[model samples]
Target: MASHNGVNRLFGGTGGVVDGHVHLWDTAAMRISWFRDDLGLPPRVGPGDLARAVATSPVPVRAAVAVQAADTEGESRWLLRQSAAHVPLPGPVVLQYDARPTEPDAWAGMAQAVIDDGATAPGVAGVRLAVPGGAADLSDVAGLDALCEGLAATGRVLETLVRPEQLAAVAALAARHPTLDVVVCHLGLGTGEPDASWRDALAAVAARRRAHAKLSGLFTTSRDDAGRVAAAARAAVDLLGPERLLFGSDWPMSARVAPYAEIVGRTAAALPPLDDGAAAAVWSGTAERLYGAATRTSPAPRG
Candidate 1:
């Protein structure tokens, strides 16, 4: 939000934008080994940096769910601490942790312990299970059902970072734990996937009452192809409807592809015909519902 020239025009003074996906990282504070200095990103990006990033946006970033950048409890704890003390109205955090296939019991124990501790962390809104740089196969993940159940019991969400091929597994997980809220991230970031597979899998997940999709990372996935981005947005809207879709700016990562304003503007322009109520749900309401209503300010933005 650092004074991007067309940002104001893009969001048109609409406030109450609840970004559903946000990542904060620092090499020293937490292990961001995946990040490279050559990538042009700063060594660290914390709450203050995030605030400055969105300060000049056309829409007011009323709240955001800070996602885990590293797969460690240290990262989760750091985010929770930041949430408690950040200058901006800190929102819930979607934790990122490593659940390797080889150490099922160890991962389960660690995850269970974290979930136990999360019950007391007010900002503990959700958990993320990401399969780094590859398609996710939850078939071998340990205590997956129990973890999902634990999150459900505590009113926390399970956010999955999976490719389109893996959505069937997500749908199955949702079916098994009907009470759990599962949010699929990055618009099913799969490359060279069949249209039928992506559409069918999304529809399958959408069939679940508690399963939702994030309209994020599209600019990165689509490589800023206006036609492809719009088509993907239209497909999601058509399949899941507005109530189940949430908006997000992947932020500094997406800066490689397009500005924050363009990502939001392009996504909005891509959606199918929607009433004001539906649009509001996509912008912030759904995220509020998923993360937790108490953490977000529900003021409706002006048209």
Candidate 2:
């Protein structure tokens, strides 16, 4: 229930506008828990306080998939509990648990728990992983094959965050496990020749047709690095096409990188020009179909 000059607008209708890969982290747990104690991955993310970050805007995030930041199932559980509490204005919830090949057996069991809770609850949708060579080298071991087999057996979608350099290997993984619906996060790193390698990666993923790419984390590619990543985004939409494009804020991660709205809004605005309906697909429409949130229709009110 939203209003514009006293009438509902932003949160109305059948349009399932969503940032496909937005992350939700709260101060409920020590931020260090998000990273590894031994690996020292984050300086100190500290218990992330995210609600205020999402407060101002009417971004009714119908469904979001948080990636496994290379840890155990503990973080995933906390996120689920957080999702269960919010109501009405907050919107229904769901999450994607992170999986790593290092602990295949443990990751498998964690996947089951996530599905058992998420799939049945209506908000939880799939499991997330870092594709070989994208984050960690895929050529390192037979881990990907094992992860795929497990996901195929369970009928879960696999979300992957890959660097442009890792596209070929990712393609092979997708081909190897055709049964799994793969979500490629980050528009395959940024676009442009300076990083054309990543763009080629996006092209490779799009060629598979089974692959889906998320327009998330531009802040990682730009702000902290270069400048606006719209050029990179436009390059991806050009190669991958808006049909396969999905929007995401990358949330808490963006807290230090970019405001949630800034990342999502700028990416949406910078998307390669799409004919009316096509733009909606990248911004929210297609996410509804693949993530399965479309079935639960909600009203969309204009801001």
Candidate 3:
């Protein structure tokens, strides 16, 4: 058994560490249509595969919350099963539930599915809804609200990955679901062209206390600009505070850009000075709060 205590021991006893975002896919399962054999990415990444990967992490990953890589319910179910089995993830596994922005009924159905299958599941954390590239649409506000209301009822975090220009729309959705914790992935897509609006939009969303930020994938977006990544980390800490910030690997996708360990090392190096408790919050505690993983404890990993 890979105990939670095992990971704590790995990081020199920094206590429990949680990976806020992890993506696991099985190409053979036909879940990842974007995957091409020509791309030369791994054909599959299951729970055991993750154990190997995280075993190499600079810090022991006591628990990892996985998000869906394929846009399918099968993928979500597969992750939940993995979590139920305690397969390398002490999870609040975030499942991918796709609902068209214009379709509120569709959102309602998807949200209900989460409540039905995942709401009370110990391994399930909630859902991640992907916002396609281009402008975001809230024209279906009622539908979006239905999806959020369902999520709030289940106590799951609503995670979204949106471009900079689409952030205001995200903030608008957050406003509609004031009680829901909406986590903005990749620092509001801050990795691209230098845009002042990214910072402004981030500030706007940060003003919403229920909004949270994940410090991952920024290096890939910033083209590995260490200085820029560092500045953004500091700025996010300034605006959102350490309690609202969480760490994620954005793995496999990030693997194409840099080693997983480097991503972890760099993110830790980039953060602003924080007290021990505050640093723990960014590394693991905040994620626990967002998804209700605090009381779930497991044994340590083996040597």
Clashes of each: 1, 21, 9
Q: Over the stretch 1-303, how does candidate 2's per-residue lDDT look in tens digits?
A: 122311112123324456565455433353524344354223423123344554533444444444444434556565555555543212333333444445545444354455444333344455666544434446653345665665555445567666666767778788877776677777657332326666666677777776778877765534433334667776767777777778776665665655655554555455555665676667667676666543322111111
- Per-residue CA lDDT of model 1 for 50-161, tens digit only, reads 7877775566788888887777777667777787787444577787645544544433233444544534355677778786355455766655776676567667788888
lDDT of model number 3: 0.71
Q: How good is model 3 by TM-score?
A: 0.84
| Per-model CA lDDT versus the true structure | 0.71, 0.54, 0.71
TM-score per candidate:
0.84, 0.71, 0.84
Candidate 1, residue 207: Cα displacement in angstroms equals 1.2
TM-score winner between 1 and 2, please give it.
1
Rank ordering of all candidates by lDDT, starting from the highest: 1, 3, 2
Report the poorest 10 consecutive residues by lDDT, candidate 1: 294-303
Model 1 ranges with Cα > 4 A deviation: 1-15, 87-89, 100-115, 118-120, 132-137, 190-194, 221-224, 294-303
